[model samples]
Target: MTTEKETLNYGPVLFHYDLFPEKIERHGKVKKVITKRGTFALKEAEMSEDERNWFTHVIQRLSEIGFHQVVPLYPTKFGDYTVQLGPKTYYLMPWFASDERNERAKDEVLLDHLGKVHALTLKEQDFSNEVVEHSYQYLMNRWENRQFEMERFTEEAEQKTYMSPFELTYLSHFHQIMRMTEEAKRRLRDWYDTCQREKRYRSVLCHGKVSRNHLIFNPSGEGHLLNFEKAVLDTPVRDLAVYFRRAAHQRDWSIEEGKALLDLYEKHVPLLNEERGLLISYLSYPEPVFNAVDLYCSKRTQYSQIELVHRLESRIRAMKKIRDFCDAIMIAPPPSMDENAPKNIHIHDEEDHI
Candidate 1:
């Protein structure tokens, strides 16, 4: 550990206050500065003035809404959220102690805050039907291309004189990949139809990178979200999809465990019907297949054939778990407008989407 006697200085920004650097810790691009005032994390990234302003606004908004889960950025004495020293730009934020690993209570708090963030940030807008249709068509076309690639690979493998171990393993699971793709397409079509009929969709400022690493829990077991650089204006399910996928993967794709996590989130903010359908669509996609295929075909072959086979096998197991989860939590289709008055669609526990 290195300590600085004088305050840290960068370009026009200088810590003139009683800020003695007690210790310094570096993780990737982020530098944690432990000082007498408080522990602060620093990151050097290329950020424009507008981007800096946007980040400041987001943090301020979250703080104003009483959502303190986000690690707040401390402006310099000059009241600037970011400082530039020559060509390099730096941002500062208070650091909270994070548990080395995720605990159940920590995750619960994380989802609770996330749901509140989504609920508060949600804005209703009448999405253009054409735009929605086009997006769905594009997704379906991409899925079709992936299926075609899988078929091409299978045929190539069949024609080979001696199939490699990876090829044999992949070939064995080809049907499963195809089935997953088909299911994804079907769910996507349903989502598109629902969106088209609804005409409107809800969008929220999502914490795009919802990973365990980004979740920081204090000593008291309160969780705070860090790294909003990838945050975007998207459907609230975007965050849920990321969180649930990682959670499910960590828990061996346990359907009950995933549902329990979802239950925690819904306790704070219940998901709408279209939102649930979209979540299914997002989870149904054969991301593992696409990822494995991309890696296998890429010029960089870092892993051995055996390693690739193991990776694929792991993915197959994960995919199976996700499929089981989807089946268990499948929301019943909406009633036809002509059949009868629309009945409320409720998830398990009989809780209605607010």
Candidate 2:
């Protein structure tokens, strides 16, 4: 049953769509709004005016290009795709119930859909030295800084006569972690060099946050994608790296499964050589492990030493799996390029609103 307080709180936002919620169930960042009209997913996000506009544009543009698998935004009575109430923004879509039967094959479906999106929007660019150099140097410097910080943390832990369990765990694997970091840097540099030599690069409309959770099956068993708030124009590898990295952290995820998924994606849009290298570079970095250390440093008192150690250990294990995954794909060649691969994708000027 819907609480009176909940209905009152959400009523103003729903007013724009003539939706008076009978029940509002919290589901992560979304609200399951049950109303007389029908069930809907009310997505709450903190987006600026510019972001809201771009997000709508991304959805509209995808549809314009014949991609309609996205969960569509329900416009208000006033024709606005989003309703803003104070600091929060709300968008509406028909809520699809979770289907456990389709859960197992979600990854395959996600990858296949991702590849289709990438293939459709892929744009080859004539590289600008300024862009390439700035990107390369910026990432390298940021990574190097993070590497230095982790090293300093290790030094501090080593100097302590009696280190905490988390610190000791981190220290033991510190050298192996550093090796991965270096390997990541080497691959990144190689990607940059290849780009400079080739004077080329590719960009696609990346989903930014690619996950099984962002997908849901409709009543007819067709998968539809949602939550494209973080979409951006970047290398196709950006989405792949994010998806693969998170997937690797799962206990059931295997290298063969990842490879098969990658193969499925490649069938639609085969990666260029440097793009593959860049993907490897992105995956090889042990950022998740570093994040664990940050959490330990900032909130150590909030969690037990054993808890922190287990957290760090979990990330380290994931990194080891990622290492093996990278090795398996290091020499795997990109599939042959598609003759009908998207070309002539017209990207507007940034001033014109990307």
Candidate 3:
């Protein structure tokens, strides 16, 4: 980190207490501001007026709902959440102390906070049937293309007189990849049918990027979600899918651990029947197979044969774990929603202020 002479001019900001900047430390696009008042984080990003407003509204709403896991943005004297200095925009938030939680503990905190966020943002609405059907068709078409590409790679590899080590490895696992793809398609079809029959879907403002990097844990072992630039209105399972995939991959495809994490999340926000089906379908998608195919067919060879083989093997192992987990959960009946009802379903209509 490099020290910067130009500290954040906080005099113009509507701070609750007096603030005196002691030093400014720069780390890429973020700045750590140490002040007599307290330490805070300053981030610079390009955000439109609407985007800024949306972020401000989300933070304020979360705060209003008593969800302290989200760090609120400090507003400027002009009552704007973001401070604009020419073309660049900046925002300030409190710097939370890092927690000393183990890997599994960290995941638990993340899912717990995520469940709270989903519960607060969840809304019951009737999604357009056409839109849902179109999404399902799009996913199915993409999966079909992936299957075709895998087959093409297998055929081409068979024709090659000298097969590379990576090619051999991929060929060996091709059958398993195809099996997973077929199972994924079947699950997706089931999910689509369920959605169509239900005609109602639950929507929540998902923290689009749910990764360890974006999750900030405090000393008390509570995790706060950071970076809302990519946040969007989607199903809660979107976050769960991203999290579960990474967690399972990191732990080398441990189904027991993955299910335990899901159970932790369920304790906060129950997964509905449709939600469970959607999660299983999303997890069933052969992401690693698609990645392997993309890398093999790329114009430039970026990785060695050994590295490629290792990557593919790791992916196959993780995918198998995910597949087994999905199969087990799909067969097991979804837990009762009443067991995980939201503590406060009523959201106050507070005026937006950040």
Error of 3 at 172 (Å): 1.3
Q: How far is each candidate from the true structure, as Cα RMSD in Å? A: 6.6, 2.6, 4.2
Candidate 2 minimal-lDDT segment of 10 residues: 345-354
Q: On residues 1-354, what C-alpha lDDT tens digit does candidate 3 reach at each position? A: 333336335433314234556777776777787887788888888878788778777777778766788766776556677776666668888787666554446777777788878777777666698888888899899889878877888999999999988888888888888887787788788878888887877777788888876777665656778878667778788999988777667845477777777877776667888789789878878887679768867822887777777887888788888888887776765555444557654233233211
Instruction: Please give the lDDT score at residue 107 for candidate 3.
Output: 72
Give candidate 3 misplaced runs (Cα > 4 Å).
1-29, 35-37, 44-49, 83-89, 102-104, 336-354
The C-alpha lDDT values of all candidates are 0.71, 0.90, 0.74
Clashing pairs in 1: none
For all candidates, what are the clash counts? Answer: 0, 0, 0
Instruction: Put down candidate 1 lDDT per residue, 226-292, tens digits, no spaces.
Output: 7777677788888988887667666344787777667766655567787787888888787876687
Q: Estimate each model's TM-score.
A: 0.82, 0.95, 0.82
The residue-level lDDT of candidate 3 at 211 comes to 84
Report the C-alpha lDDT of model 2 over 1-354, residue by residue, as the tens digit: 788998898899999999989889999999999989999999999999999999999988888777888999999999999999889999999999999999998999899889878877877776799999999999999999999999999999999999988998999999999999999999999999999898999888899999999999998888989999999989999999999999998999999999989988888777888888899999999999999999999999999988999999999999999999998887777665556644433343443223
Which pairs of residues have clashing backbones in candidate 3?
A: none
Rank candidates, lDDT, best first: 2, 3, 1
